[model samples]
Target chain A: GAGVSQSPSNKVTEKGKDVELRCDPISGHTALYWYRQSLGQGLEFLIYFQGNSAPDKSGLPSDRFSAERTGGSVSTLTIQRTQQEDSAVYLCASSPNPVYEQYFGPGTRLTVT
Target chain B: AQRVTQPEKLLSVFKGAPVELKCNYSYSGSPELFWYVQYSRQRLQLLLRHISRESIKGFTADLNKGETSFHLKKPFAQEEDSAMYYCALKGFGNEKLTFGTGTRLTIIP
Candidate 1:
């Protein structure tokens, strides 16, 4: 079966610009999640969606960061007014449910200059 | 708040040697524990979960509530075991995972 897939494997943008990262979860998976990975921060959870509704956005660093899932399959993470600190690899994962093992995507490496 | 801690930022061991990667977490209630591994050039993937009590690739972890620990161990390390390991925790039911700082294990051939 095809695993989770992410788009724009790498992105470079200027400060204050906005960027959108896309994620396509595996077929029939009901749970999707976004996370960020960096040098000093390791990996940080950004948001989680269950059937197109985000229940927990606590990990979002700021209001400028938002995510949305549609059709319970595709998700997009948008970072508005990006900063250099926002430079990192954005990862997406999908699971059968919250308790099941998650399958990960290759991730989008965003660079903010 | 829930927190997962991997004390060792990096670990190196010789092939066939015993290995232990420590992971400790602090949470107010019962939480689910997991270990994630990312091999070079590969996406991160689950290595094991405390709830399953199953070993993967010759590695095992035991969750201890008394000490708040879930250390991953392998009796004989292999060269292919080298990778970045992350310890994660989540509240039971629907909850996001909180990950550790991660430990980069380098198995010497």
Candidate 2:
């Protein structure tokens, strides 16, 4: 079976630019999650989506970070006006339910200069 | 606030030796604990969960509520076990998990 997939495995951008990272969850998965892995922060939860309900945005570090899942399948994480501090590997994961284990993607390495 | 803590940044043991990776967490409520492993050049994947009580590839973790600990261990370490292991916890209501800093384990041959 196909696992979760993320596009543009690596991205490099200027400090003030914006970037969009995409994630395609495993087929039939109804829940999606986004996380960031920085040198010092380990892995921090970003946001989560379950069905048609409002996404859990509590983990978004700032107003510039946002994520959306469409058709209950694919998700996109956008960082607007990114800063050098945003440099890290963005990881995506999916699960059938909140209590189930999640399958993770290879991740997109974002470098903000 | 829910949090997972892996005290060791790195652990090294020879093949066929016993191995233990300590993980402690802090959460106000009952939490679901898990151990995730990432092999060389591979995506992170679930190794075992305390709730399942099933060992995967010879690895097992026990949840101790009194100590707030869920340490992963194996009787005999294998070289293939060398990788980064992360301890994670999910609270009863939260839809996402809080992870720890992770421990890099190396099983020397």
In model 1, pairs of residues that clash are: none
The digit string of per-residue lDDT tens for model 2 on A1-113 reads: 99999988999999999999999999998999999999866689999999899999999999999998889999999999999999999999999887788999999999999
List, residue by residue over A1-113, the lDDT tens digit for candidate 1. 88999999999999999999999999999999999998767689999998746458988999999998987889999999999999999999999987788899999999999
Note the chain A TM-score of all models in turn.
0.96, 0.97
Model 1 misplaced stretches (Cα beyond 4 Å): A52-54
- Cα RMSD, model 2: 0.8
Tens digits of per-residue lDDT, candidate 1, B1-109, equal 8899999998999999999999999998999999999999999999999999998999999999999999999999999999999999988664688899999999999
Regions more than 4 Å wrong, model 2: none
